[model samples]
Target: MTCRIWGRISSINVRKVVFTAQLLDLTFERVDAGAAFGIVRTPQYQQRNPNSLVPLLEDGDFTLWESNVIVRYLCARHPERGLYPPELQARFDAERWMDWQQTTLNPAGREAFIQLIRTPAEQRNAQALAASVAATQPLLAMLDARLASRRFMAGDTLTMADIPIACEMHRWWGLPLEHAQHPNLRRWYDSIRSLPAASGALDVPLS
Candidate 1:
């Protein structure tokens, strides 16, 4: 049986899984959920993913949630694809960036996104927005330095690290901020943008 993904296209988390699936050439059906779609709270959906989050993966009898975990599973299942290396050290290196994204970048980015996108303009929290942007700069600088030295986050090869980070990067670049001097980050992002999967799955307007 074919795999199925439950999530809206506009969601960053869902975009990560969709992009990964596209990279692996895996055919899957995607169902809208979360925010505007109320299916996420349904009893059947709750049984599959109690968290009621976007990007739940259902492959045959197996089910999985968490976008990064889903990507890791897909890469592990298709080792020959080279998107997720089987080597322990290399995989660890890629995993490091993924962890960093979850722990460090996403929190900061989400705050900025919520203030700028989700919050009403009249009642938006400028102070909080400023703080979030300040917090994010150092992280972006770190990514810029890493990209300066290597073509991709996990060295020269594009691995799972690129997927999650790229999703965030789309938001970062799309936001109305003065262009910064992260040339390397910009170059790497542009390259990823050129990918067919990235274009199709990730190039959505920020919500």
Candidate 2:
């Protein structure tokens, strides 16, 4: 059976999985399933992913959720691509960055995204958006510093670490707010954004 992914393209998490799948040249089908699409709350989707989240993956009889974990699983299946990173320390370093993207960076920027993109202008929360921008800016600076010395998140080559972070950056950059230019981060992001494989995922307009 062809691999199937459930999620809308507008979601950063879903984009990560889609970008990873594209990078690996994997044959898969992506279904629109969240937000206005409204399929996630269905009983069938809930059975496959109790969280009822976007970006659920089903390959044959196996099912998986959590975007980053799905990325890891897909990359692991295609070890020759080396996106999973074989070296012990390198693999862990990738894991740490991926975790940081989810736990730290995403939370900090989420409110800004919500207020600016999702919420109507009249209903937007200025204080919350300000706080979210403040929290996320420092993290972006840290990522800039991290990428200054390396071509990619884990090292010279694109790995699982780069997928989620790149998707996050794509979302951040798409926002209408003024942003301080982080040259190295921009450089890295541009390289990834320019990839043929990243066309659909990274190039999509922000909702």
- Candidate with the greatest TM-score versus the true structure: 2
Query: Cα deviation of 122 in candidate 2 (Å)?
Result: 1.3
Question: TM-scores of all models?
Answer: 0.97, 0.98
Write candidate 2's Cα lDDT for 87-164 as tens digits: 999999999999999999999999999999999999988999999999999999999999999999999999999999
Provide the global lDDT of candidate 1 against the true structure: 0.89
Q: What lDDT score is found at residue 65 in candidate 2?
A: 97
Q: List, residue by residue over 101-151, the lDDT tens digit for candidate 1.
A: 888999987878888888889988989988889999999999999998899
TM-score for model 2? Answer: 0.98
RMSD of 1: 1.0
Clashing pairs in 2: none
What lDDT does candidate 1 reach at residue 49? 97
Number of colliding residue pairs in model 1: 0
Q: What is the C-alpha lDDT of each candidate?
A: 0.89, 0.95
